[model samples]
Target: MRTLPSTGPRYEPPRPGSNGASPFLPPLPSSRTPIDPPDPIEPVEPIEVEPPPEPERRKLRVVDVQDRASLGGAALAGLSLTWVLYSRILPTEGTLGFIVCWWLSFTAFYLLLTGLRRGRVVLADRFAVLLAHSGAALVGIALATVIGYTLIRGAPALMHWNFFSQDLRTAGPLEPLSTGGALHALAGTLIQITMAIAVTLPLGVLCAVYLTEVGGRASRLVRSVVEAMTALPSIVAGLFAYVVLLISFGMRLSGFVAAMAISVMMLPIIARSSEVVLRLVPSGLREASLALGATQWRTVWSVVLPTARPGLATALVLGTARGIGETSPVLLTAGYTTYLNLNPFSGPMTSLPLFTFKMSQSPENNYISRAFGAAALLLVLVLLLFAFSRWLAGRGRSGAR
Candidate 1:
């Protein structure tokens, strides 16, 4: 029998025949080796990859020097053109017209210069961004101007010590700045605002809790009413207080009535704002508290309300601010007075807004100055409260649920 060639899987060289060169038909070349399969590839170890570099932080100066130069040129041209138009072309120097002129000139120049340097797409983007930033800056500038002007006009009255220590009862409208202060008005405002807060906070907070935590179909109607009340005019609130307390009932127009009117204005604001804040608390927090066997009210009181404390404070402050600056409600309910009245129930009392309004209407320069001073004080107080509220919000931001 003929033996079969070795059937092993590994590659092997062809066997030589009985005689040399007799195995295959072709003869091998002298310098060539017989064909063989390539050697098996060795297994490779895994590669170690280097970590990527961190990205560089961007600089705050988004605008380049070229852009700044363009802006400067636009400003110079705008101011010059505004001056010429205001001085020579206009019939009056109430240069509000000049403001429009300057803005138009600046916009025209800015677009022209930017379009030339950059392509149209880039120019459009830059113009839009700059316009928005410029608008915001303009608002800031206007606010600063108002505050500064009020301070400058009221400097004489504010500098006097009697403005704080005494009341308008003894000081005539024509009297010198040193003789009288808005002490009574200031005191009345504080007391009335305090009373309003006393009435509004518990009710507002509870209403918010109901809307956010225990909401039902009735909550929708309540929410709609609150939203509508937010836009309710100050005069309407005043009229409601007047009709309810003075005309319908037998109550006098006193500081308590004023407080009630302010309470009306403040209540919806606080409740709506508090609802927003409470909704911002995470669902996970309530779930976690309840998961731990805490009751619903306990979860709200311990987990939700505490987490939202700062925001609630901010809402309260915002409501107080809205009521504090109001004039119409105080006018109808408080019946402006100059004398210091410690009791909210007994007699007519003045507030800062009322005092300022009465003083501004007078023909005397001293009265106008006093009005401006009171306005400045009000502005300063509002700004301080706003800043404080912002601080509270920021402090609790990291811990918010």
Candidate 2:
């Protein structure tokens, strides 16, 4: 390439709207440039966001058990119960299999529950609970149905006037089984139970009141004694009554002696139950009563006792149930007689339980049937008493309210 001259004039291109003129359009003022002024800068704003609330933790529910486990437990429990029932009825020698089945069923249920709860929500857990509950309900219903059926089957012998009116002296298997009633046994049971209640109720309530209210330094000793009393065997109580009342006083077996024995059995149960109920009474109510210028006794009677009446009644009913069912003590204390005896102190009296015992031993099938009927009747009486106690308690509660 040839070298160019160093001092030559160079040509230049025209700028946009130079000299206030445009090549394609009208020209603008020379002071103003063709390029627009830089646009005003705007401040940048930061983005806003909120973190989500923490996820709630799932709670365990009763229904979370695995299906296999639940079924197994139910099966085991059923098998065990059946084995026990069969053993009771047949006096079987091989109890091991029954026991094993029972335990296995229970274990299976537990396993099922554990297996079902993997990575589940609270609602899902309830399925296992419902299953268990339903199983229990079904078992209870089945047992009740069987008992009711048996009781009904045996009740015909109990319906006749003679069943209530005639003594065992007049009753023979050959004699119309429907002719005799359990009136004498009924009377004896009533008398014995009434006497037992009379003896136990005041003593038990007082002991409980003392334990809950007045007992301080000696409370532990009292509690220990009460607990010991609770464990006292019925036969032991019967023997005690026999020794104390019958042997000591040269008294023959009678309703009174049986009543004393039953009272001894009932006292501890009543005391323990009453104490629990009394303790459950609201402290605020007691304080309020005291603040209102009521004495401690007044406060207890007016506020505490009234509030705990329902539980107290329940205790009484339970005590009566226990007392009425006691056969050993009654057998030891009250000599059974076929004839009706109204005098609790003088003659041997027959109670429903004693009558049932005696009747069961009879060689005749009729007597056995009568025994079952008597048992059913006894159960019904207990239920009635329970209902009555509940009704009374409810009424008292409503009145308080």
Best by TM-score: 1
List residue ranges in candidate 1 displaced over 4 A: 1-67, 77-103
State the lDDT of candidate 1 residue by residue for 194-301, as single tens digits: 999999999999999999999999999999999999998999999999999999987997999999999998899999999999999999999999999999999999
Q: In candidate 2, how many Å is residue 71 off?
A: 11
Winning model by lDDT: 1
* Superposed model 2: Cα runs more than 4 Å off: 1-138, 389-401
TM-score of structure candidate 1: 0.78
Residue 245's C-alpha lDDT in candidate 1? 96
RMSD to native for every prediction?
Answer: 17.8, 22.9
Model 2, position 31, has a per-residue lDDT of 70
Residue 257 CA displacement from its true place in model 2, Å? 0.2
Query: How well does each candidate superpose onto the true structure, as a TM-score?
Result: 0.78, 0.66
* Candidate 2 global lDDT: 0.80
